[model samples]
Target: MPLPNGYSINAASSDESEDAERLIETVSVPPQCCSARLNLAVLMFFGFSVVYGLRVNLSVAMVAMVNNTDPKPWENHSVVPAACPRSSGAENTSDTFQQPDGVPQYPWDSETQGWLLGAFFFGYLCTQIPGGYLSGHYGGKLFLGLGVLGTAALTVLTPLAARMGSYWLFALRALEGFGEGVTYPAMMAMWARWAPPLERSRLMTLSGSGGNFGAFLALPLTGYICQALGWPAVFYLFGGAGCLWAVFWFSLVSDDPRTHPRISKEEKDYIINAIGPQGTGHGWSVPVLSMLLSVPLWAIIVTQMCANWSYYTLLTSLPSYMNNILHFDLQSNGFLSALPYLGAWLVSTLSGVVADKLIEKKVLSVTNVRKLFTLIGQILPAVFLVLVSYSGCSHILTVTFLTLSTTIGGTSASGVFINQIDIAPRYAGFLLGITNTFGTIPGIVAPIATGYFTEDNTLAGWRKVFWVSAGIGVCGAIVFTIFGSGELQPWAVTEEERAETDKRRSGSISQ
Candidate 1:
């Protein structure tokens, strides 16, 4: 019988399977081959590194910004603004506020700072669905390049915003957030297109490690820039770097191996053959009913949310925390705050390589390997966070435990990110966007909660925040263990979907 799409439905003949195997063998890089793929991986890594470096620069700058200002206290003896003489010392006091020529300054209020920090995620949270859809329809290259360009433009504008005022600063930050919202989904879609099944875990991990590296670089580098040239320079330097990357990206990258002029025909065949049946065609909308009803997807979303809570809390609050609680100078605080991310970058790269090797060796089933790493990622970090919280004021113990926590947390790239590819290679970007949208909700809430919880620098307050993070981590680990799986469910496409796919195929053939 003819297949529904006019292809033969019969099982592949031994001859056909043999032909496919021979083609793959002829085109495939040897087991140790890493040249072309490694080059592509490095390019992608630096792309994400630039994106995240710009994103995190603001956090480091906030440390210096806060320190340079004088604190105000409310007192009954203090004269009101209305009661003070027009030329009184209170009116002319330079210590009360420092308004540099091109730097943005705002009242030194914790709540306002929290709002500035959390506001980016608001735009980030809103754009994932649209970004994923665009990446699916137009291919990742277009949206990915656009995302880079948009963010770079916004980054350049940030310095101007600071010079303009606090309101402008917030507006520019929101725009930057919106532009960056496109990045992950676009990159995820690119992975679906470019990565071989065997190499998916490793490549995704490497891509993710770039973000950690960005965090590592941004803290100290931006801090030094802010210190030397003032905070506005941080935006100008990173923003310029991002713009330069966009130029390189548009010239070098393509959505499919088939279209890339630099990719050899042999490599194209290898990539296409490696991906097998599911890699063709533009992605369709997820079957919302099925995904919503799936207990597994819900569990994954919950686990992602839990993971992000800890991650964003550190990203948003760490520089300030080191300066305040650890009593480090601005330069020292920047260096110390970066240590965790340095550890994270190492752990992320290593875990991905190890996970892929285990799969290649057949030492663990795909599902079990992913689960093993997921548990390690969540549970070990949870334990370390608790330890870090209780380490008293000992700087050495504090840094050690925080480093351990970040290193362990880096394994999520192996577990959660790679599992998206495993479960839905065809729709990996959309599925990831769905879960990431939920995960980023905590990005909004966490910084605000950190602001409120640590308002007084009391030990109890900080302890409470750590406890909540640990509890969330435990719950995420439990949910992932119970429901996360590496296997894809059989497609339950409706008749309409099948028809649409068939029509598209026919149209391609007629062309």
Candidate 2:
């Protein structure tokens, strides 16, 4: 057989050559032909489903755990050792005292609580680059499973930490964030492997929607668990669920379509051909400089930052908002706060499918389709934020605006998440990590900022936070419109590099 551009035939034994040829023949799936690919995608999506479910459960549990009074009066009034003075190290002095109004404050005070909320992002932000690297080096299945397991273990420990004291709780949450951080990149890597070109948007959107589902389920489930069995039970339930998911994931998933024993050859070929030649390489190093310089990449990052500011704010603070501002009881707060996430779940599912349909029919260019969703997602929410800010204690209007804002943001999963795949399948994970790192800055900032803003429970302070959120949303929309494109740049890979990749793949197959 003639050698392709950048490779030559190996001088191996006939047996080796025959095995390579047979494997290649078996794996040469036609586009959209493989049932195994779909099965794998579904399994992977479920893995993400449970991972997110457990991860977000903390948001709901926090409402009960942080505010609960210790039954043992001695435990409540335990004196600090001289070596552990309230102001020592990073500890907040205020956490040691009950509030003047007799409210049960977090043991670590307002500043310490801010740190606890923000600390998770410190580990989360730090892990993105490394997680992407690991996903590339080790493949998605192993890293993703291990990440879930790690997250599960940490989650199980959270209740124990709370029982022990505040410092341990902060430490455990940060560790959980580190483990959970790997999930998105791994999911992106899986999409690059399993999804056909036509189905990329829909599949990615559906997979990403699992997070919304998790958020939606977490509130009511954790609330009930807290109410019935105490806040500790919430962590125990989510943690146990995560571990079960990891067991199934390890049993079922493989990183490559070819390696999956259950996948048909036709489907494997289809997936590979649809993804094209550039998808073959899997290495820790990515074209970091090229991604950094790309205007579209920066646009995606900025949009993610804006989108996540609202997302994290709601995730971390909405329960408190519902309790304090709306005056809902715990059960009511849990059920109501979950509504926006449910709305987002529905919106994401529909938008993803619709975006794919638009792409399939050629009715809208991929760029236009992405832009349409991104525009509606950000702009509408900004409008709603303004309304939410000015509603002035009208509980009904405030909830309505909040719901609209979150539901609109769901359109981002269709736009930015899928667009990352469109721009570069090979580096999709890395690009997502970079964008996510940028996005998480707000995750780190928003909770603390909210604490500062709402210190006095005044409407004016709350209004300022919403206005800032609105302004950020508007800025993201403008940037995305100006710079976002679906087209992959030539500089992302050279002609020589492409030829070299094709050569290697063809040579390996023909051996």
Candidate 3:
């Protein structure tokens, strides 16, 4: 099927009506090797898994690293703390923080711990734009592989750094963050050379969901590793795994389809044909002024910042909320915190397939599909998040609402999350760098915002946090619905090609 915008996919025409239709032929090659693009997706998946694993392991590992005999700030505030009555099976579940048997635990207070936890974002912010540009100019494979490898090397030194001083560990984590910051944007650069338009959703989702799955695995498993071995082993094992994965990535993946040693010519031809001349670079400088002024670009940016505010708020604060209000113990909190991501991982993977199917069948135009899923991902989650706020101290209701919020949010994998590629395939990485830099604001600010709102740790304060998240999510969805486009932006092309690339159906793909 040929799209007016010049994208062609091996899909059947929409209707069997009066119009003569042709079946787009499929590429049939000798079974000499599995699909290289598919292999790239898998490698990208594990790379993302390692990315998130290293990122979140510290959340769990630090608990064992700290000697927290002091009562929690909320508990110590009132003469008789107002807390939910302990549920059945929650007795003696008051989080008893034991210093890991053999390892030395730090005497750092909560303020110090907070800084340590946030140190990663400091360095993470440094590399976004540079990473995206450099990866595009050069190859993403080097930066992506080196970034992970560097982070792994730093992770191995975490235990040593912690033993030296609080400042040492903080600096080390910041370095690790700087190293890993290239990952998201670099991967986008890689995909620009590889992912076909129809396959974009599934390919991106397959990799993106790895972060969710990584969190699902890391959260609970980190605790288990710490308990069974020692706190140091948590860093050692995950870091080692990252190093091993980097070796495989470097060995197996390449930057461009044209240069891939093992890729089949027939498959490569199909990719080239589907993507056309635009798949390769257009040999023009990026249209910075046009990108700055573009409405759709701003729409996507606003939506990302707002959406990420909601996402990061829950990611960083959910454990504390459960522990404080819902009355789950640390161990239970870890498992429960991980559960939402499990649902998210499953939904993200499935929604991707559904999205591709919808576009292929012409059930909805690509723009509508993006809008529909963004609405589902962003707006619908607001309702459930509100339900979570009102659910009060009910553990079952809160968990259910939160899970519903997260699972529904997974549709973004098909929606605005991947819209960067739709709008600007050539600049997808740079665009992601811009948006994610804004998105990272939430990662830094949300935790701090949640802290400010819930300083008293009252049910009302916690309710405010969820309400704000829901409100931000709603606002983002509204902006995206109004201005977002799946049709490529005019700025994405060279000035010469811009006029010839007449506006595609802004809402639909059909004639």
**Whose lDDT is greatest here?**
3
Off by over 4 Å in 2: 1-34, 68-108, 494-511
Residue 491 C-alpha lDDT in model 1 = 48
Worst window of 10 by summed lDDT in candidate 2: 4-13
Query: Listing every candidate in turn, what is its Cα RMSD in Å to the true structure after a full C-alpha superposition?
Result: 8.3, 10.1, 5.0
Ranking by lDDT: 3, 1, 2
Among these predictions, the greatest TM-score belongs to 3
Task: Using TM-score as the measure, name the better of candidate 2 and candidate 3.
Answer: 3
Output the lDDT of residue 508, model 3: 47
Q: Which stretches of candidate 1 lie over 4 Å from their true place?
A: 1-36, 67-104, 283-285, 492-511
| CA lDDT of each prediction against the hidden true structure | 0.72, 0.70, 0.76
Which regions of candidate 3 fall more than 4 Å away from where they truly are?
Answer: 1-33, 69-82, 87-92, 106-112, 282-284, 495-511
- Look at candidate 1 and give me any clashing residue pairs: none
Model 2, span 1-511: residue lDDT tens: 1122222111122243322232223223345433666666666667666776776676666666565323343256543211112224221222232223422225444456666777678778777767766775567787778888888888887766776778887788788778878878877777776776667776777777877887788888877776667677777888888888888888878787768878777666566655554454456567778777888888898988987887888877787666545545556667778889889988988898898777666677667778889988988988998898888767679889999999888887788656777677667776777888888899889988988877654567778888888888889888888888776555455354456556656788999
Clashing pairs in model 2?
A: 28-269, 29-266, 29-268, 29-269, 29-270, 30-270, 31-270, 34-267, 95-108, 95-109
Model 1 residue 88 lDDT score:
32
**Candidate 3, which ten residues in sequence have the lowest lDDT sum?**
16-25
